[model samples]
Target: MVDSAIITDNSEVLLHFDLKLEDGSAADSTRVHNKPAKLVMGDGSLTPNFESCLRGLKAGDKKTFTLPPDDAFGMPNPDNIHHMERSKFNLDAPAEVGMIIGFTQPGGMEIPGIIRAVAGDSVTVDFNHPLAGETVVFSVEILKVK
Candidate 1:
């Protein structure tokens, strides 16, 4: 058998990944668009639970598995949902339900918040990740492991 470099805690990896919901709807894919992504194994870019699954995998390896909410993006936090004043939004911009808006934080970082409802002066915006609370299937191909 040919020996290969295995993924380790500090390994730098390049990989292609496809993310899908439990119902088979596609969420994201590096193979479908853009070049393979690079990451250091211990970087917080991926959840620890998710990175654990990649341990020991080598280049040219392909893997697919389902991850529960806690293992994936984790359950949505209610605190992530906030009620905003309608006046804070641009009147020209369509503040319709389901639309994602960029909100600037006090720290000057911008985050996306999806509008859930518009009632009177209140606009319900959910800042949780879109995939939060979902069980997802991940398909990954390890292109390079250093």
Candidate 2:
């Protein structure tokens, strides 16, 4: 039998993975959508800690690992939550809690913000990633490691 190639710093990887929360709710999953993710090792595509987990694994290897909040999406930052004026939103659009709106920054980059609350003229918008501060279970099946 031929030995399979191991994942290394230069590997171009194609894999299926899932990110689930402690409550057993899936945050993201490639298998659910019938798609696989591709990435080159040592790239910023995966966090340093996350990339390390894939290192040394070979094709066809399946593994599950848990990441702390910091290692995953990271702890939520209070600064990411902003209080905006109600007039800032377009009048045609409904401004309600739990609504995700795309906000254009000074650099013209569109960033998504979730409405946390609407009180009179003040609308609290959280710019933090939806998975921020969430510890996640990451499971992966390495389909190819070239």
Candidate 3:
């Protein structure tokens, strides 16, 4: 019932987060950008599970927790993997494995796709999120909960 000191629906929160993989390798961190994230609690930007973790947290609280693939970014879908002809790519810099490229959708919105493989004249592009299927640990330093 104490709304001022704790996170609640519609509360404006400012926090820094560190996202890491199961192997303890760094995935991403707000500290690296030096700009803490600002968002309203219960916003659609956060996954339901992630928001649940922040529900009771207050300013100056720091916590780290792990999320399964489903609750995190989610599992990869086979339908997200597309095969295209090598000719579809620019000849100057052809598609190569591990390359991330922006693919324009029918609505003109661009999404990132990773080049997974190249065999003969075929190119495989994975449209799944880069962190899909990952069990990640998210550490949050709550700066301002209201």
Candidate 4:
């Protein structure tokens, strides 16, 4: 058994989850594959609101919650879309729809951008998360809390 309060800042947890879109379409589900994901709390990886929902949950507890766009991946920003010359990419790389390219940031972090479209000389890349701006429904089963 696991204490719910222990699931706080910097705590590590293992859980299986199913994520669904607003349309009731299944986006991701651990139940189907039976693999649990590990997550560290308060790492900025999960929004505060989303973390709040997990508060007081113990192991073996199953909970389903809905999160708005802001509480999830966040709203997509138009500025995250960048149009670059096709020549900027390596010819061998092959720019295709859904290809992810890593761009080096000022702090040396590699940011991934998905290729949205390719025109004559311009290639459109979007840095926004693929699930951004979409409300999410999560069904979570707490497997372990540490």
Q: Evaluate model 2: give its lDDT.
A: 0.91
Score residue 40 of candidate 1 by CA lDDT.
98
> Against the unseen true structure, what C-alpha lDDT does each candidate score?
0.92, 0.91, 0.92, 0.86
Expressed as tens digits, the lDDT of each residue in 1-146 for candidate 2 is 55498999979999999999999998899998799999999889998888988999988899999999898889989999999999888877767999999999999999999999999999999999898999899999999888
Expressed as tens digits, the lDDT of each residue in 24-134 for candidate 1 is: 999998877678989999888888987998998999999998999999999999999999888888867757899998988999999999999999989999999999999
TM-score of each: 0.93, 0.91, 0.92, 0.84
Segments in model 4 whose C-alpha atoms lie over 4 Å from true places? 1-6, 31-33
Sort by lDDT, best first. Answer: 3, 1, 2, 4
Query: Which candidate model has the greater TM-score, 3 or 4?
Result: 3
lDDT of 3 by residue, 111-143 (tens): 999999999999999999899999999999998
Off by over 4 Å in 1: 1-3
TM-score of 1: 0.93
The residue pairs in collision within model 4 are none
| lDDT of candidate model 4 versus the reference | 0.86
- What's the C-alpha lDDT at position 36 in model 3? 97
After TM-score superposition, the amount by which residue 85's alpha carbon in candidate 4 deviates from its true location, in angstroms, is: 0.6
